[model samples]
Target: MNPYVIVSILVAYFGVLMVIAYFTSRNADTQTFFTANKKSPWYLVAFGMIGTSLSGVTFISVPGNVGNTQFAYFQFVLGNLVGYLVIATVLMPLYYRLNLVSIYTYLEQRFGFWSYKTGSFFFLLSRTIGAAFRLFLVAAVLQIGVFQQWGIPFSVNVLITIFLIWIYTFQGGIKTIVWTDTFQTFFLVSAVAISVYLISKELGLSLGQMVATVRESEYGQIFHWDPKSSKYFWKQFIAGAFIAIAMTGLDQDLMQKNLTCKNLQDAQKNMLSFCTVFVVVNLLFLTLGALLYLFAESRGIAIPGRTDYLYPTLALKSFGLLAAVFFLLGITASSYASADSALAALTTAFCIDFLNFDKRTEEDRKKIKFRVHVGFSVLLYLIILIFEALNDESVVTAVFTAAGYTYGPLLGLFAFGMLTRLPVRDRFVPLICVISPILCYIINKNSEAWLNGYRFGFEILILNGFLTFLGLLLLSKKRVAEPEVIPGE
Candidate 1:
């Protein structure tokens, strides 16, 4: 519970990451940073991705969310299972065939210059906001757990947080992230597993009794059948599939890891392996959530007003020093695991997608990559400050909500390119992508009133993508009979 201990744990943890970065990055060049020289182990990528995918949001929010939503989030996880299958079978193959450094280049091949840029732009936007939201949760926790004791400002906390990520990632990039995330994921998963055991011990429940207690408790419910509620099973399941496709399959931060694999088959294997683990890990989070709520009720501890605070509050103030240490480690590992990857992917995307790094000389590429990495680091820092000013909702909910709008166009763009043979008005692609999310925002805001009390949940992403798809359709034309040769094919 001591603030000094929390700081020491954090310092020591980063020290380890610095060591890893140094070794992994020793002979690193742009190729090593961008694609890990296309030699990352499938199993390592699969395992490390657990930390990247879950991040701090799941570490804190999902379990805390159990008090309110119970196990309904699992429905979404099931949907994610289906979505991951789609990614493995469908999306990954296309990315592999294209030999894409940035997946957005597929858009350029399929559609045109504008469409490619549009897809990459949305990725940049979606990832920036999403990463900031994740880091904000961890930063808020650090402030309360360590900085607040020392009277440090939140702005200083944000800078320090982003700087740690940049320092480790600036050289090794995805190569460093692949290994560091694996290490962090071990701690992340262990933290939850150990916390669950400690809570069971505190509650005097055996393993069987713990399962039975969670199963029988009010928080155990996982399905909602109501057609209008956001948690409706079908809605969440379907949304989960598309969310996986859009956020992971379509995302650069995640796909960059996948692309680092030696071949398409390895990437597919990685995805399938990751999917099974992803589902099980989420269920574990849901179980931990139920246990947390149960522990709170039994101990007469008041849940915090912000559910995001519940886990940190108990671990720091109630559970002994051991829980506090793992909680800090788990959160830090999970958060930076995701954040560091995002920083690398952001740099990679900008350098490759926007800056034409491939066309540049080696020395020029090095300087540009360094500056862009630093630029995005500063950008993330600024956005976290903005989130602290404006955000009032659970971070998980906010992330999904934002993804619904931002990633929707990516879903739409990819679907249009793959599902249809029609040639689009390439110049008009940006306009359609822009209009889709704005329309989604309007529809979501008035859905309950306009649709007879129908609340939009994660399914809003599906609707957003559909609207974008439709918009693209309107702008499409019958394909010319001439066989078109894609550049570099």
Candidate 2:
């Protein structure tokens, strides 16, 4: 593959997005920047979310998983189905009732400033780390495909990539994100669909043959009963459910779009719309993986140790020009879809939550937004540098594991407040949330010694939630000042 050609294509693609950023981001108010004026077409938000949720990490990672990582990624989607239901019914109502600008505001009402700040801090930390990792995976490809080919350092490449994201998002933030994400999502999925068909053709299998092969393979089985292991079916399914709700429902990047729906009824429709697309799109990617496996077997292609490279390698090896372009375009589209929105949301949350820009004058708001945007770009870039230094398959996996801890408290805090009418001790709220997760981590680490090699899996979320719930029971004292919910029209 001519790396120059790929680089040129990517540069051109970004130029197009910048043009988009210029127009969509014009005359932005704070409300417009943060929530698209809370009037984005719900259907469009639903479509755009496919891009945000399924990053380049997912683009490369999910299909490759089918052959290497037990193919149980599909089972996670099953959990997602249940998770989406809970979010639509449970989380959505709470968010709507509060008419919250930032989701973490609910923590303030349920607990206090300390707890509110605590939750937002976790979200900021977790999201920054999580977004960096996602971009890190895409960075690996860019480093190889563009920068290295042009004799540029990977760090330089990372800076430039993040810089581009920052450039477009600074003006409009989420307002620009919803529409840009829709464009990126379309390209990403289209690229995947094209590459899959081309790869299938090269393998000499029609689409029908490919589907039949996957259904018969070991990778296709969706359920497992062994609770003792991480790959076991039920643990994963349950884990998948919790992961979906926590990551998607509680996540600002995803939920911000949900909140943009014109009304609760429309928002509910958007969730269902997103859910259906999520399942179908994942199935398409899985089928692409199955096709790759069958093709490799038929031609005796040596599969790489890292399953993530399957799509790229196959594209490069077979039917040269079109396949390579398809692979590159798909991967690029996937990365930008998620990463750009991430930059927007990170800026939105920090500006809204911690900075209290609502209290500031217009000039101060712009000044603070600029400084914060620049600072975060630097911070996220540094994290990507470390991610590159570690540069192993398991390193990205570990990054996810670490971020997983942050969600444990989010789950616990939100569950306690929403499910129970009981007041949480406002003063101790932050302390309890912090303590519960750390203790959960300790128990998770020592479980082998504590229970004779008994390790926790997805159910650790349940434990973490339970501990926070118990702590809330122990700590909460006076009822809050009159509930802060303002009546909606």
Native RMSD of candidate 2 (Å): 2.4
TM-score of each: 0.98, 0.93
Error of 2 at 128 (Å): 0.5
lDDT by residue for model 1 over 21-115, one digit each (tens)? Answer: 99999989999999999999999999999999999999999999988889999999999999999899888888888788999998887888999
Worst 10 residues of 1 by lDDT: 480-489
Q: In terms of TM-score, how similar is model 1 to the real structure? A: 0.98
Estimate candidate 1's alpha-carbon lDDT, on a 0 to 1 scale. 0.92
Name the 10 consecutive residues with the lowest summed lDDT in model 2: 480-489
